[model samples]
Target: MSRLYGDPIEVWTRDGEPTQFVWHDRLYLVRRVLDHWVVAREWWKTSEGDPGERRFWRVEASPGREVGSYELRFDTAGSGWLLMRAWD
Candidate 1:
């Protein structure tokens, strides 16, 4: 199972791929990208706002300990990035 935080994070990317992200005051380096996909906005779910497409990444990351997988989402409408879930 994964926990959802929806917290905004700062990410560093290389060649259009995420390499690292800052969360909970720690830097987690992405060791591997497990998967990636795009989620289109659900128009019915938004009555007042729409953010377009959201890109997600399932990655294995490490912060000087045992590596763990995480899910991240990037909002294309300028809402920035979010650390959606994490497997610890």
Candidate 2:
């Protein structure tokens, strides 16, 4: 099972893919990308030519220890990266 969180985090990306991220004062390096996909964003919000989509990445990461699974979301509105869910 996984727990949900909407905490904002700083993520470093290379070639449009996440390489590392910091959350709760700890840094996690992405070991592998488990999955990647996009979904439509909130329907209540609308903008010109905006498809309203949310970019998501499920990754296996580690903070210098055993790996864990994480779900991350990229805020399209420019708020930044968010730690959407985690499985320890």
Candidate 3:
């Protein structure tokens, strides 16, 4: 897995599942969802911050002909999405 860190991305979802994502000016279609989970905010990290909950998805996708695995995160507080990592 490689870190994309917190790179923001545009995603297309259906029935709450990520169907595709646009990253770095390219679009990748999700072929499979390897895993999905939620992480609670670490309230202890900042006394005045409410980072909110995060939902994560590990998926397999194809940008072209080759399929690869990637991880994406959704911030519930702001409804923002991030590409967390890619296993290439």
* lDDT score for residue 12 of model 3: 95
User: What overall lDDT, based on C-alpha atoms, would model 2 receive against the true structure?
Assistant: 0.89
What's the TM-score of each model vs. the native?
A: 0.85, 0.86, 0.86
Model 3: residues with Cα > 4 Å off, grouped in runs: 44-51
Candidate 2 Cα misplacement greater than 4 A, ranges: 42-44, 47-51
For residues 61-82, what per-residue lDDT tens digits would candidate 3 score against the true structure? 9889999999999988778999
Residues 1-88, model 1: lDDT tens digits: 7888999999998987799999999999999999999989886677657748899999999988789999989988666999999997
| Model 3, CA-based lDDT | 0.90
Query: Candidate 3: worst 10 consecutive residues by lDDT?
Result: 43-52
Tens-digit lDDT string for candidate 2 (1-88): 8999999999999998899999999999999999999888665676655646679999999889889999999967664789999996
TM-score attained by model 1:
0.85
Over 4 Å off, model 1: 43-51
Report the CA-based lDDT of candidate 1 relative to the real structure.
0.89
- Give residue 18's lDDT in candidate 1 (0 to 100): 90
Clashes of 2: 1
Best by lDDT: 3
- Global lDDT scores for all candidate models: 0.89, 0.89, 0.90
